[model samples]
Target chain A: MGRLRPGHLVEAGFWLGLCLFLYVYSFEFDKNIEIYKFGASGWPRAIILLMAIAAIGQLIHHYVKGDETSSQIISAAVDDGSEEAAHAAHHETVKWYLSTFALLAIPFIYMRVPEWIAGTSEPGDAGLHTARLIVAAILIAVVVYFIRHHRVRVMLMLPLFFAALLEDFGFYALAPFFIIGVMYLFGERRPRPMVLIMALIFGFMLTMFVKILYVGLPVGNIEPFYSIGSWVVTVLQ
Target chain B: MDAFNNFLQGSITLFSDPINILIFLGGVIGGMLFGAIPGVSMLTLAAILLPFTAHLSAEQGIMLFSVMYCTGVYGGAITAILFNIPGAPENAPTAFDGYPMTKNGQAGKAVGAAVMCSALGGVVSTIIMMAATAPIADWAISAFGPPEIFALVFFGLAVAASVGAKTFWKGWLSILIGLMIAVVGLDPVGGIERYDFDMPYLLAGIHFIPTILGFFAVSEIFVQAEKKVRGSYKAPKLSVDFPSLSELFAHKFAVIRSIVIGFFCGILPGIGATLAAFMGYNEAVRWSKTPEEFGKGKLEGVISSETANNAATGAAMIPLLALGLPGGALTAMMVGVFQMHDMQPGPLVFLTSADLVWVVFAAMFYANCSILLIGFLETKTIINLLRIPFQFLAPLILLLATVGAYAVRGLTIDIVVMFLAGVVGFFLRRSGYSIAGIVLGLILGKIGEQTFAQAMQMLHFEWSGFFDRPIALGLLIAGFLTLCGSIYGAFFKKAKTPQTPDPDSA
Candidate 1:
């Protein structure tokens, strides 16, 4: 009925492909369970089928109503007519796409970085820990140096980097840097206020999460950072 | 009479302990503060606190969440009235009239009416919840077998999928994705693994907490980050002038109707306060003598929305407490709390943990009552927190979300899951998918599978057995009709309407 947007086609295609892949994968489940008539795969298969149908329906709908953007639909649901939704509806630039890609890479980096570093070493090897600490230092330095220039992209990538290094660097060592980095990216330029606010937030977090709740936050496995984290806990206790 | 006595006993037990009183106050204040902050949902705070709740006594913990539920629903109204930024999605409707009133320099009256109406709605709904829950649980326990339970879950999932999405298909697809996520672990009925892919972590199933933190908190941060990148809003001036008793009394009918609408909406398995507020505002407009006054600084608009959303908070607990079907994401998190405390929510909770349930009831009642005083006194003070920029708040939220996800199972993998879920959730939200539907589907999926297995066993593998059970049959019919209706609305009904070219298309 109307000209279809390429974005809608891609989205529909992604859902369809995902649903089909899962449907095929569902067949791998053991089907010969003695107690129940519907086997283990039955429930998943049903869901996969439903998902496939929905995806196809979405494709059809996209074909029929090609002009309606997802943001418009969301605005309709929100019904606020706010400027925020209007801004969100605007076409994304290459910067937005790159930042999104970087954001999506966070979990992969978190999972794979250690594996890449360890490289056939046993878990908790001394040498491996030393290697991880050295690499972490280098990476942190690079991130800190680049963050000012690539604020949004680096900010997007910071969480996983923080998470990955959290155990080795400890919460105390990394948290302030994380806070300062984010605040800086957020356009907090004045050094005095940034440091003061960071200290306040850091103190509050230390008192609340670690001291009061006993949340077992990671105190680094490596030196200096580990000692700092332990020292803070000791003082609070 | 028994319920009344239990409620009184609960109140006495709650007020007797100084620590509990402190916890009650803390929860109310904390809930409101968190709820009032733009870019932070109550779910984020709930998830962050979920790990710590394990340490408190079950009554104290559950009571805390119940109190938070009430205040969090009301807290967003202040920001909506003053700044035009709803602290939560449920408060979005409040800004329609509330912000308009602020533009007209009636900000005080708008905020006051919102405060009073929110409390009134919450108090009335809590009373109704106290009366309704036990009977509903008892009836459900007795009348609902596995087949009927499955049917009910089906109906709930169907209704959930059809609500919030631009197209019904997207909503259904979101639920299907959630169901798919739920199917990842070992099959509940049989010991057979379905999608674990030989991973030890996958065997235990994906914990909903990290998934929720990612979806609600992390994904929200990304969305907000994008918004910040685009542009930002300015802070508003702080002042509140409460309306007189006579002024409030004039719109009594609107208040009553919203309470009713909110309560019924709340009792539904998947619908939550956001929809209730919108429905309430819509109904208020429909019933008003001069409907044009709505969305143009009408006091009734603020009153209806604030009232209904808070009203839904208490009523939402009904389905959660009675059937273990969470009315929204926060209630789903409550299910996590229940599991942590070695308690199953459904009907047996009424028998085994009646005191806990009653305490929650008492806490909600007190919490709602406290909102009137606290809302009146602390509106200006609370709005000050909004001055903190979204950029500063964003990273802090991410850090908290990290701890929250990691704290749940002490698994680093879960943190990864949280980030992955966040990225996916952002994309999904951008595509008009319902996050609530997916979350509900994930919860309901597990229950539905288990019940379906049990029902099949009971029926000796006879597929037709579902048709024999009247309740099951009825629920199935309802589910089917809902799907059919949604399909018609999405496809056939829309086909009949005149199409206009979207300006963005050009």
Candidate 2:
């Protein structure tokens, strides 16, 4: 049998980790001794066990039958062994990691930052606190690795950046800047078209959403922008 | 006569209101524009527009989304004909003969044929849906209990096998993952919170709209950003060369055949418009005396694909509107819309929300007319629509996806969730797992659980009672057969045979 592919290992590890979490978490729910049927944790525990079995089945199938489903799809999608294809594949793998790390970091920070800022970490929830810290540290390490390798692009960070800054800066303040950042990352050389396009699109959005439809959006927490949003709402009304 | 009256009343209600007319037109034109753009699908547009629809009355909301759904299919065909890039995968078959026709300087002719046939197909299917919906709904209401419903959902889940993934196991795994995600929130019977991990956001479970945005729109942005997007294309100057009445009549047989095939294909779970189009094309090729002309700029090819693709749209709605089992991803998202409006999408909805049902029917008919007019008039301009680079487009999509997710409940955490879902969706697709299967399971999971729980209660927790209801027993057998067949097909039948990528199978 051939050695297992990296994908196989990664998938198995993910399932195993998830299974462990599920098994541990299930312990928190007290079984109702009166009833014979499964309780709250029963369904989830059953599912997790089935998933682990499936993962192991997958691993065994890969080794025994020499499964090549993932690699075949990759080769099919890429379709060529040329240097450009290889480069593109490499870049795709990079983007995938970038996405994974950013997904983990942005949500963790967004949820934890407010509490962390308030110094709400307590010994009572020390384990949860430790878990959060480990996730944050791993995210930071991923970011460091990307920077060191120069694989990180501005566009890759745009979503995470927007998620981080959106609440404080508000839609009015941040949307145009996000558009500009995206335009720059997409390799736009001309400033004139970018500005013109941004204005047209954002202008239409503000009028339709805020002025006409009266859809609520975040107003900037800081001074003049808050006033601007209030004035716009007032004027539109 | 009563059904006809209701249908007429629905049309009048929509037409009488100036705002409804405006929204209908906007939905059609906008749906087309979104579908015509590569990497921007009708699903993306509908999901983005879904929150906005909440402000409208239920009838108006139904009309807007229905119009969008109908026109979006046609929109994808426009780019498929012009640039050889399908705006949606379902339209991919159109590019086979469409690009050749474009190369032959019949771009206008190709566009006209595609637009006309798409309208023809959609109109026919809408008529079918209109005629079929009430009877089917009546039957469903009488036939199905909780056990039968569970069996039906199980069948729906089993349809994941037909999703044309690289391997069936991968697709099933994706569904399992989706089911796992679905069960993350409060448990049904006792209301005990499951996997919220102490976060308030998990209380209601993962919101459907944000999940849809993350899976379809945001993941597309990532995929588009990774590829090198060229901003320029060589194209002939366009004009509408709409087929003469006689010319259309000449291909009536092909169009009719395609309509029938597409409608039936749409009714089947998991096999969607993409398959319909290819089936239509293949059938046309098989019947044609001049089969060699098919890939070499045949108008019949365009008609067959465009007709079947659009026809499938209305046909797919039958199962969704009647059974509450979405036939494909697009309708799966529509289920979320129904949930958004606090309407459950089963047979009883026809009784409770009769006006909304007929409004959808009327909106589809009007949307097809709008496609006919706009598609003809904008043939020249529509070709220019392809000039927008993925660079500019990707950012706009990301922004829209973010805002769409946030707008659902005006929550920033939803935005984060959207991005997280997007990342997961991206990796899942890259790894050869079918997103459709995952989406099906996600949308159906809660319904499955609820029905199963109710069934257990009804049976007093006797597992054997599942097989006691004759209709439920039959459906359960069917579901089992489908699952076993899929497993056999995925492992034994397909494992040894390397298959090429077929757009129709996609």
| TM-scores of all predicted structures | 0.93, 0.87
Task: Give DockQ for candidates 1 onward, in order.
Answer: 0.40, 0.26
Name the candidate that leads on DockQ: 1
**lDDT at residue B333 of model 1 (Cα atoms):** 77
DockQ, cand. 2 = 0.26
Question: Scored by Cα lDDT, where does model 1 land?
Answer: 0.79
Flag regions of model 1 displaced more than 4 Å. Answer: A67-95, A102-118, A130-138, A141-146, B494-506
How large is the i-RMS for each model, in angstroms? 4.5, 4.9
Residue A43 displacement in candidate 2 (angstroms): 3.7
Error (Å) of candidate 2 at residue B433 is: 2.5
Candidate 2 lDDT over residue span B255-282, tens digit each: 9999999999888766668678878887
Per-residue accuracy of model 1 over A1-237 as CA lDDT, tens digit each: 355666677777888888778877887885778887778888888888888889888888788766343321223333222224424645245456665585546435544565577774564677777667666666667677777666555655777677777767778888998888777777778899888878888887888888887777778777778899999888887
